[model samples]
Every structure is written in structure tokens, then in C-alpha cells.
Target: MGLLAVPQPYDFERSLDRFTFWGVDRANVWYEGGLHRVVDGREVRITPAEGGVEVEPFDEAIAPVVRKLLGLEFDLPPFFAFAQRDPVLADAVRLLPGFRPPLAPDPFEALVSSITAQQVSLHSAYAVRSRFIDRFGVAFEHAVAFPTRERVARAEEQELTALGFSRRKAEYVLGIARADLDFDELDTLPDDEVEARLTSLRGLGEWSADWFLARHLARPHAWPAGDLGLRKAVLAFYPDVTDVRAAGVRFDPFQNLSAHYLLAALRYR
Candidate 1:
């Protein structure tokens, strides 16, 4: 086993709490105080340890991917310092001291997850997504590798609809899978350009693009003001804030982290 040392003031379990329902999570499995996922075709389990988490059957090759999945690379002190200036944010920080936003490591998986989540309750999304993954994803012992775009591209719209996707969402998923956009090259673009390219696609809109920047690329300034949950979170904490998108400016360089922290507070508090 090898250890991945996340930054100090990190709570491994709390950071991974989003995956608490192991049964519904296909790509990642969180159970028995460990996280399991297929990394480079091999299933690995990560458990909390002294400074960070320990990876069993660890390979140097998959270390970076693991770090990305757990969001271990994010530096928190600066964001913590910034939060101290605001009472609402400061209280959130105190409530969840060591939280880190778990991320979608694969751009394709990230986009697909967003597509699954659109206009649906998260529970319903998880149910449909779980079925979708079972049908299309490559199953491992404890996790499922998300279906490749090529696999999705080849699938008929009816097949996706059968997996619980609404007709339009199914069409959108197929369109994205078959679109000419190179998912890897997206990270090279500026946020505006990224949003432009993504929103130009049929199914993806500004909200999906914003989350792609925040959750997939980990862009520091990405904030999804169009997100209903985020708007609610902002309103709950900042009653004076009516426009969460415009209010995003207050979070500044740490907008992405601020959104994550605010959402986390709503979930964990």
C-alpha cells in the first residue's frame, strides 16, 4: 500500500461523503470506510490513514488519477483565509473544517454525470445513472468504469431512454457522444471559450459548462450561479444576495471552492 498525503486540515471521510451510498455509485464505491474504484484497469481501495489515505495495490501510474479523484491537490489555506472575512463563509468553514470537494476525474464521465443530473432530483438522477452504468459501463468487482463516449455514441436514443433518460436528454446525450468536440483539449481553453464551445452543443447549456469548469477542470473561478442548489445555498447564507451569479464576484479567486464549501455545508450540516 502507498499513502497519498492530502493537504493538512483534510477530513478524508467527510470529503468523500458524497459517495456514501455505495450502491448507487457506479464509478466509485465508498463503503466500510474505504473507497474503491478501477484505476488503469485495476481495482484499488483507498482508506483513511494518519496524514491522508492509503491506497492498496497502488501503482505509481495511477497516483495522479487518484489524487484528481479525491481532490487532494487543492490548497485550502488561502481559501480558508478568504472565508474569514465573511461571517457566513466563516461559519461554514468552522462547521466543516477539513472538507475537500470530490471531483470527476474523467472529462467524459464528468459531462455525462452532469447530463444525468439536469432537471432531476439527485436521488432520481442517481437511480437512472446507476441503471445506465449497469447497462453501458464496464463492471469491476466493486466499481464500474463509466461507458466510453464511443460506446454511448453507438447507442441508439431508444436504448438510453430505456435506461430512464427523457427523450430530449437521451438525444442530447447521444449528440454529445457523437459531437466532434475533443474533450481533452477543453482544459487548454480559457473559461469563457470552454463555456462557449460547450454551450454551443445541443444539450449542454451554461449551467453544465460552468460545472464542467468547476468539477472537471478545477478552475479556481468557476461558479455555477445558474444552479438552483447553489442559488438556494447563497440565499440561505446571504439573504441580501438575490443574484447568485453576480454575487459570485465576492468569492473572487476562490469562487469554485466557495461554492463547494457552501454546498457541502448544506449537505453535511
Candidate 2:
């Protein structure tokens, strides 16, 4: 057990809010007292620390996961500086300073989540996903490891439908899990290539591809132009921006981060 110092301007509450905004589900994550995760066969706990976050049972195996989960690689000063040029973004940055875009610890997990989230209300998605995880995932002390690819690949369509997944969604999940694609190698691909590769898979479309880029790859320029939440948030915040996708072009390389902040702002507002 050890403490990991997060970079300055980190707001644990804001970050936690974003993490749990969808809903509480111990099947995947637990946040009653602190953050808990089961990663690489180890149970790790994270709590607020004076200068950063404190991790229990910290080891090298969990280091990279924590870094990516908390977005340690992203330097926010430049984003905050850039936000000043746009009133909506400036407000979002000010409202949620120190908030960083959270990444999916595993690309496969992100892919599963993207599949589960399709065409459903986030609340419904969360409930169904929670049920699915509780049914198929391996349990830990306070959390469950997201179901493995092998497990999901072998899941029966009827079993998934019983867990609230539509037949099509079940097929999509199984297709992704059984695919020959190497999820780890996706990080090494260029943004366009990543999109092309992901979209090639059955059931994964533009929305899924865009989210994988933003949440899994953490590509700074990746933007989900078709995201309804983002479009609503942009319209609510910037009334003149009739075309959210076109409006997002202004943010360029930082559009992903910008979209994240906008989403967070909408949640808190």
C-alpha cells in the first residue's frame, strides 16, 4: 500500500462525480469511501490524499492502469489556457477546474461499454450493464473485474438478453470479444487507422469508433461529433453553434478534452 501524488489542480470530488455520474454499481466499481479497482489480479484502493491520491497495495503492475485511469499523462494547463478563447469552454473549465478526462483502463472494456450504451438512455445502459457485469464478471473485495473477452465471447445470446441486452447488442458484444483483433495494438495506430480498424468490426460504427478514440485511446483530437449529449451540451452552452460538429472544429487537437469538459459541465449543471 502506498500513496500516489496526482498532479496539481486535481479535484477528487469532481473527478469522482464524473466517474459515478452514470450510477453506482459495485459490480464494476465501488466508491462509497474511496475508489476501488481490481486490476491484473490485484485489488487496489484509492482515496484522497493531501497532494494527490493514496493507493493501497500499490505495485508496478497497477501503475500504468492508474496513470491512464486518472489521465496522468495529460497536462491541463494548456487546455485551460486554450479554453479562455471560448466563453462556453472557459465557463466549463472554471466550473470544473482540475477535472481530467477519465480513460477506460482496458480498450476491450471500453468497446463493451460502447456497445452497451448504443441507442439507450445512459440510465438504462447503466442498469443493464450492471446486471451483465454482476452476472458474468469475477468478483473482488468491493468490485468486479469486467468480464473477460473469452468469457464474453462464449456468452450465450439468450443469457445476454436475459441480462437486458438486445439480441443485436449481444451479438455485437460476442463479435467484439471473439474477433482476432489485438486490442492492445490499437494504441499504436494512427487516429484514422484506429477508426478504420474499429469500424471494420461488425456492430461498431462511427459512434463506437469515435468513443474508442476519445475514451480508450485518449487521442487529444478525437471528437464524437454525433454524440447526442455533446450536441445538447454544446447547444445549451453555445447557442450560436447550430452545428455542433462544425463548431467542434475550432477546438482541433483538444476537442476530445473539450468534449469531456462540456459533458462534465452539463452533468454538474
Candidate 3:
């Protein structure tokens, strides 16, 4: 098998439209001098050598699947029609470049990680994730591989607390891990069913589940309704609104793409 090495300057400034850009907050990805080295398949390791990023494509057999899975190929509509309606949103989209979603190999890991991220400041969520990775995660070469349920099912709350999780959070995390659930069974069900399964987890609310569904599963219509940033953003554009939830009515068909489009449009400035 052979490999394809492409070096993308890791800037999300105008590129948050990609499908794989998950887990990272917008502001974090755009900080000066930060590079996201995304490795494709197990055979490919994206190492940053002295000269620049190296894309060693060992075992070329699986390159196509890797490319497809990693979103190395796409046909972006010349213009996202959704960006045209609101003048402010249009301005932001123009200012920011377009991007893809950053996804993980394991859906379960992504789900749990996104769960721990609920209702917290971006900094705290990141700190919690890092500490959790350091404790429960394993190093698969460069990437800190999120641990599987079998591995973490037996983890103690005190152990997780030592890793910076709250007592309640630790219990919730362990409960999911111990259940031998991949959650893929819910995938074929309708969206509401998926929502039902996720929000039923203790401590997860409609908003948190909605947030998780939006980023991880790429649900085409999520708007993160209860988010303050979202509320503020919605309000910034509609200063007259006493009910911000109704403001979301403006983005009916394009709600999923609206957040990144809005963020990208407004990110640089």
C-alpha cells in the first residue's frame, strides 16, 4: 500500500465548515501558532519533522478508505446559500474561511468526551479532558487514545476524582463505560430516539444532548438553543428579541451549518 501526504496549515479561521472539526472550541483552534496534526490511518503518522509536517503513507492499500473517512476529498457548493440571508452572518462567513468537521475514530469515546464538556467553560472542559486522558487514556504512538468501556468500566470514582472529575461526573462516566454500549444501535433509529437515549443519561439535559448530537453525529438541524454564546450571538443580530428561542426561527432549514458559519464569519474579528 502507498500513502498520500497533504499538509494543511492548521488554521480554522475560515474553515470550520469541515465535518471533522469536533471537540475543539472555535477560539482554541484559531489561537496563533497552533497546528492540528491529524493522522489518517494507523499506517499513516503525521509527524512534524524539523522541516515541516511529514505525511508518511505506509501500507498504501487502505489509502482510499482513509481519505474518505478523514474527509480529504469533498465538493463544496460554490456558495452556501444559507450564508446569504443575514447581512451580519454573511459578513462573518466571508471573513472566515470554510472548514470540515474533525471527528474521532471511536464514536463512544467522542460521546463521553462531549458529555464531560457540558455546562462548563471551554478552559475547564479542556483541562478535564486532558487530565482524563492522562489518567484513563492510553498512548497509541502520538495520539492519546481514549480508553474503551471494557477498560474504564471498573474505574473508581476516587480515581477519576484524582484525575479532576467531580464525584457526580465520575459516577456518570463510569456508568456508561460499564454498560458495554457502543451506542451504534441507536444510530438507525430516528433522531428523537437518539435524543431520548442520550438525554436519559443522568446529568445530561436536552441542551447537552443537543450539543453532543450536533458536533459528534453531525445532525443537520441542531442549534445549541440553550447555549449562552448562541443566545448572545442570536441576540447580537436581533437586539429587539425578548425571546431568543424564536430568533432561531430565522435559521429553519440551515440551523446545523449556521453556528460554524456564524462563528467563522465572526471569528477573526
Candidate 4:
């Protein structure tokens, strides 16, 4: 075990709280305990250190994964500077200082999560996803690894439906798993190209693709304009904005981070 330093102004507790929200806890993401599952097949535990968070088993190898998961790659100075210009976002920035947007370490997991979230409350989505993971994921002492594409691909649509996915959603999940979509290749593609490719797949649409960009690729401007929570948050925070897309335009290149802060504001409100 080793300790890795977190970036300045990174609130480990707040970040964990957001990650573990909506009963979406997983063995791989133990927010309360600060343990995360890394792609290199290791579990790292994070805790607050003097000026940063300490990670156990802090092999430099897993540093990138840690940074990605915690949104440490983002330079907040620019975002904070931009936030000060908007009243609603200014208040959000004040209320949720040091809150960085969290990322999905796995793009496949992010897509599956987006598919599960469609037309359902977050609580419901989390329940269904938990059931799906419990049924297919590998379990360890502390956390369960997310099911691989191969595992999910092998499952029948009926199996997914039985696990609480709607019939359409089950087909969608099955389609994605079976599709030859290259998850790894997406990293090299621009946002528009990625969205176009993803939307071409069955059951994937602009909404899912947008979230994949936001949560998986961590694209700074990726905005899910159709998200109900985002719409509600925009309405509550920016009353004059009847159109979410217009509000998104106002945020411009930082719309993704703005969306996250808005969601956090709604939670803390």
C-alpha cells in the first residue's frame, strides 16, 4: 500500500458523496471508504492527507486511473473564473467549492448506466443496475467488479429483463454488448464523431451518447440537454431560461462542468 496525493481543492468526502449518490454504490466504488477499482486489476484506497488525499498501494501505475475517476485532470481555476460571471453558477460554485465532476472509469459501464437510466428515476436505475451487477459481476471481499462486455454480451435479453430492465432497454443493452462497437477506439475520436458512431447503434441516442462523452470521455463541453434533472436545475437556478439548450450555449465550453455543479446544487439545496 502507498499514498498518492490528490490535487489541491479536491474535496474527497464531497466527491465521494456525489459518486455514491442515488444508492448507486458498488463494490468497485466504495466512496465512503475511499476505495476504487482500477482498470489494471488493483483496488486503491483513498484517504485525505495533509494537503491532498492519500491513496493506498499508490503504485504510480494506477495514478492515471485515480485521476480520471476523481476528475483530477480538470483545471478548476478557469471554471471558477467563468462561474463568477453567472449568478446561478456563482452561487453553485460558492456552495460546492472544490467539487469536481466525477468520471466513469469504464466507458462501457457509463453506456450501460445511461441505458439503464432512461425514462426511470435515478433510484430505480440504481436498483436495476445493482441487480444486473449482482447477477453478472465478479465479487471480491470489498467490491464487485463491473461485468465485462463479454459477460454482458453472453447474457440473453430475457435475462436482462428479468433483472428489471424494460424490454426495450434489455434489447438495447443486448444490442450494445453484441455490437462490434470498439469501446477503446472511441478515445481517439472527436466528440461529434463519437456521438455519431454511438447513435448509429440500436437503443443509443443523443442522450446516451452525450452522457458517454460527459462521464466517460470527460469532454469539457459535453452537455446532456435532455436530462430532466438538468432541465429542472436550470429552471430552478436560471428562471429566465425556458430552453435548456440555450442555457447550455451560455455555459459554452464548460457546459459539462456546469451541468455537474447544477446537479450538485440541486442536491445541496
CA-lDDT, candidates in order: 0.88, 0.84, 0.56, 0.82
TM-score of each: 0.96, 0.96, 0.74, 0.94
Error of 3 at 55 (Å): 5.8
RMSD per candidate (Å) reads: 1.4, 1.3, 5.5, 1.7
The lDDT of model 4 is 0.82
For residues 180-242, write the lDDT of model 4, one tens digit per residue. Answer: 879989999999999999999988899999999988898889999999998889888888887
Query: Residue 50's C-alpha lDDT in candidate 1?
Result: 84
lDDT by residue (43-79, candidate 3, tens digit) is: 3443333322334454454454334334344322422
Count of steric clashes across candidates, in order: 0, 1, 22, 4
lDDT of 1 by residue, 1-269 (tens): 99888787778878887775323687788768788988887888999888888998888878988999888657789889999998988999999978889888888888888998999888888888888888988888888888889998999989999989999999998899999999999989999999999999988999999999999899999999999889989998889987789999999999999999999887766
Q: Write the per-residue lDDT of candidate 2 for residues 91-183, one digit (tens) a residue.
A: 998888778777888888899899989999888888888888888888887888788999888888999999899999999999999999999
lDDT of model 4, residue 182: 91
Candidate 2 Cα errors over 4 Å, as ranges = none
Off by over 4 Å in 1: 21-23
TM-score of 4: 0.94
